[model samples]
Target chain A: MKDKQNLTGNLGALVKNFSNLHSIEPDSMLDLNTTTFLQKLVSKDVIDAGVRVKPKDYLKSLVLLEYFSGIIEGDYMACKNLAKISEKIRKIEDEEDTSVDPHERDSYLTLPVVIAEAALCANEKEDTYSDNASLKKIKVRYQNHDMKIDLHSPKSKKPEPYYDMIGQMVLDVTSKSVEHYLEKVSSRAELSSLIFTGHALDMIKSDSQKSKVKTALEKKDYFSASLEALKGIMKDITISVIDEYISNLEG
Target chain B: MGKKVVQGGELLFKEDIIIDEEAVRMQLTIPSRIPIFSIDEMQVFYNSHVFTLTKNSSKDAMIKVYTTEYGLNEEKSPKLQEDEYFKANTAEVNKLKEEFIKKAVIGMPDNCYDKSLEKQACLTLVEKINHAYDIAEHSYKAPPSKGLVPKLSDDSIFNTYIGDFERAMLLDGKVYRLETIQEYLSMFQKAIEPKFYKELEKKSVLMTPEEAFKELTDNRHKIHPWGFPFIRNKIWYNEKSFKIFLDGIYWIPKFASTSKNAEEKYRNAIERKIKTDAAEEGFGK
Candidate 1:
């Protein structure tokens, strides 16, 4: 019982601190949803005494487990076909690596929580989209279609840039070319436009943006990086627009 | 946050956690600009490897118990147990790590020998999972496309096996040579008013294929406290991301928009495997 109390206290503190830092209400953030597994662990007598977590309130259990295991750990089934999340913590006894950045490490330990929490809270009902005031959104809302891209890349900055990249055409609509025999070609991946840190292209320049990329990734701020990457993605339009840009130079 | 500790298939989420629709759509958007879910796939990958690692370690523990109880290997030691003597020596094996039971109890009743065995297996999984920190992977992706995402068809099939995304690697550069692209973009080549080639000629050309290829291939992204082991999604969760990645690399090269082709093939393979398994089951019975 004492352990459970400490567990609950520690959990409440962690959730409260996380909520404050992210500006999300504790209720809105990840719920320590322990409806299923812990129910099996705690007997019926405990449940009748009003200790049940209602539903999805695994917060205390999570902390207790972590205290024992040193990370959010479980292989128990909670639902069907869902991604399970666990946060990794550094143990006091282990040797630390000198090569990796601490902040970079922070981003990873928190990625699952960040991804799941972001996904749960992201706007799901928007009809259509554009975020950058500079770019005009030509796409209209489809009750069904507008949310498709948003579901997977919840962290992407805007829908317009993706549309713009898709709008690039390097081939004549009617062509006999073998390359045209393949799919439409855009020279860059959408993420290439993000140039916050040491972007593949940016690293080639005299002033490598390595620190910026490092910082953004370390911060897990792929959304901001996506905005810059959009510019980088669009620059490839010329290379696609002029099919032989690179070969023309070399040839 | 220490060093690369977690590995593929280790990033886990509660089966019940809420996932928003925007997050779902982000990967499945009909026309994606780039690949999605390097992090997700990697987690799945690491999770699988860890499961294997855990299972093997647990089994190894069982083997250790077997060896300790029987004292078989050393010259002139007790001989290997007969097939019928399985139950007699379990008490000896159970005590090896009995105290570990206090920490975790994954409740694998299948391990008939003891709590120690169960504790070791569960702890192995937990330790490996917790050990994962600050992980990321940089997946080299094929170029993006427009209007190429097959118009929503009832027929397009998405495959989620771990190998599916990598099946069609980046387009063979030799195949999409300059002439082929020029032929495809003949209009751009012929545009007199825009003079695409003249403008193209002016931009600082950046073709260092060998360098770019090596650099891009050498580059990768990672997720969480470990390296993602696979680039594919073995479980059902993020089919959309792997589907998009697969399509951009393979389907486009075949000059095909989306089709139910992969779905059909995958379903057929499963069907065959089931039939084969049923026959084997009959044999066992």
Candidate 2:
């Protein structure tokens, strides 16, 4: 919300920048509401960067941004519609010409979260919806929010229309558990312990291994590479920790 | 007299490619559209010897494109010869990269730590990858959230393919310069602090890669993977993008050379993120 505080000052400067960059009239470019909506949806860093990096995709970006805004604002219709669209997009029929790559669809699906994460990271004071607790609350709102879809209605035949509806409900219940499970599983000490075993430690300590880690670090895939290294480490430690922990618990 | 099959070169056009249905489809198919090469057959054509685009001095303003049913000669290729010649020029490219690093590049700024350049580089790299792979394109999509931070002690080769692909793009390019493709990509031995490169010139003490990595990872908690889907503005060579270039230079060992697997893992990770996202949205069922 503090990001909203700079809206008035930032808007004028941003509009000027956008207009200058795109060679468009300032008044013709974006209205106050549209600007505020996008600002609410993403960070100023994204906005400024978007304008500079891919000006051609600006219009399309606006449409996606608005859709995200609607979803975040607790619009069930938006959420339901996006879910349906996502499902349709994801469904790969053998003969379907329009069936996009899984990565592309995934990118579209994860855009909101990615933007939210970026905003959270880029400028914390300015980002509104990135706090984990806040996002959890939004998820709760989507789950508990009133919806008009009735499975018992006469026209609700074949259970097809209610498929996503059912999916929505299932996801709401399952995702919370998934989040909880992930949280419970991510014990720093335990994960570290798995990686610090004799062989794993030797791999980490070896000059070749350090060089390998250094290479991964350079590639910016450092995190996943690190995770992969952890995976390698856990090859020996797999399931052993659970028994050890269980024994500790029993003792 | 026109030659049999034109190989080892591209048809350079003097005019801008007009947008047609074919162009639009090609553009759409590209997933990530760049400034150059809009039309599939008109502006750019590659890898085939049966067709050629050559400079003809006829002033009719109509360019002739030659096509034939001639099968490609695998034993000896003009394109392969061209590639060999290009490969021989690697030293020149390395020199260019070195100069680009020495004079042009800057470290991550201290005050703002403005990462627009780095973010832009990622966007560019992602766009190039998407374009190359024929995947549906969404520019400025953030890298997977799970890989947001660089682990200090974590050493893994499974996720090093992206880096490998990037390195290939930079060093092996015959057409586009790496700096031109993603300006501000650092190719230096050290990841110096902002304006520290200039200081290094004076002091002659460069930070080691490990030290740089430590500095970058030390403040890793502050590092966020924020991005927008429509950043199209010119993000020229800057400190942040340079840092990314610095980060992208890794030697993949033979043991961890499963690039395909790494790429798959990368895709799978994105898919997982999408599921998590879909789960979070709840779809208002």
Candidate 3:
């Protein structure tokens, strides 16, 4: 019920991570909500060295980061769908031929989770998804939530029509789980990461940023690439959902 | 001077193709309405396909397609969102796969069956030289759930045959630096490897020694198999519309590549392969 409070637990971990990166104490950047968080990002000089999100429109980046990083929670499906619906709105704005199939959306939804799991684990350099803790956490989260999911032994699945009732359960679980997990993580250091989704590609400002993202993608450092792509979505497409949702949640 | 029987090269222009009642009833009939996938849908489709070597529906899987309207000499393709073209470059690679399967690809052997219960002579010991070993290997995976994921066949070799229906989406050949067809071939050899390999393997089987030599009569004809079906948007020199014969390869132009190449090849290859397969008189009787 205390949605923002629940999210802020994980948000606290975000602050500690930021503080550590800035070589400052944890007291700094007290409230990790969008607007004030932006201020902290600047004060810490975390702007250029770490997760170089655009200081200007980084709120969009934050929304994506928080939403996607939460994939480690049992409640991620709802968050992903909500983000996607928001993205669908953005697609319509850009006049894209969009078919956001509920079935196919899982792959799109799982991407950030996979990226987060890969990049945030302590032993990232050596771990594949099969062995990654983040992946295990998510699969466990889903199972604990009563969703039948088996990573090691997967069976073929059929596509079916979307149903609203199933959609509601997905949403309900996601909101509660995220709220619970966000508040539970003790510090910013405990936060898995949204680092990869925390950037924006404002090419109007520079081409080097684009090249940096491109080079990262070509090198298959998908964490870096995801951040860049999220930034691209925010910059080239629409950021209204991120901005509006966070603003409303913060209020 | 114009040449003899065209060797299924030179993407059959919209003007050159015509469909009638007979062509419609042929073995590889041009589909009345092919689903024009969005970027995301296409990405999933391309990545899931074993033929494309994209095993896991990984979003990063590379596919090739035609950028343009690389369909047969039809008046229209399924309508796209105005911005679908620009965004199409970033997603999964194939557009032709579904139609390829629908048109004329080989059947994958089904795997789901009850395990033969070897009557254990005793409950403990396993069977040594049993009839179970004689059972031909089959794909053990159960039939895929519908709507969960669109199914792709496991026939990898048959998948290679998809290439023989070679069509590239070259942006109407404007992006190329090719001075010769061979140059174009060399530059885009990777795109056509599937088709080339399929042809190399099948042609020997599909023809008699005498018939094979006779078939080279059209070797002088230039063919660029890449299809760009949507590119017909530019004011067409617009020839008479043609229908795919379904018994031979029909070239559609750069429908798009990587992403475009995958889709274009999927469409053109499926269409032509059906016609080619159906028309194989040698394989017939």
Q: Pick the candidate with the highest TM-score.
A: 3
TM-score of each: 0.16, 0.17, 0.18
Q: What shift in Å separates residue B67 of candidate 2 from its native position after superposition?
A: 48
Candidate 2: misplaced stretches above 4 Å? A1-70, A74-176, A179-251, B1-196, B201-210, B213-285
Candidate 2 on B88-109: residue-level lDDT in tens?
6546534433332222223312
Residue A18 in candidate 2, Cα distance off native in Å: 25
> Which run of 10 residues does model 1 chain B get worst, by summed lDDT?
B44-53
The CA root-mean-square deviation of candidate 2, after full C-alpha superposition on the true structure, stands at 30.8
Candidate 3 C-alpha lDDT tens digits along B189-225: 3433455534533563444223322332222121222
RMSD (Å) per prediction: 30.6, 30.8, 28.2
Candidate 1 local Cα displacement, residue B229, angstroms: 40
Off by over 4 Å in 3: A1-251, B1-261, B282-284
Model 3 lDDT at residue B135? 21
Steric clashes per prediction:
66, 14, 86
| Model 3, position B76: C-alpha lDDT score | 16
- Each candidate's DockQ score against the native complex? 0.01, 0.01, 0.01
- In order, candidate lDDTs are 0.22, 0.27, 0.28
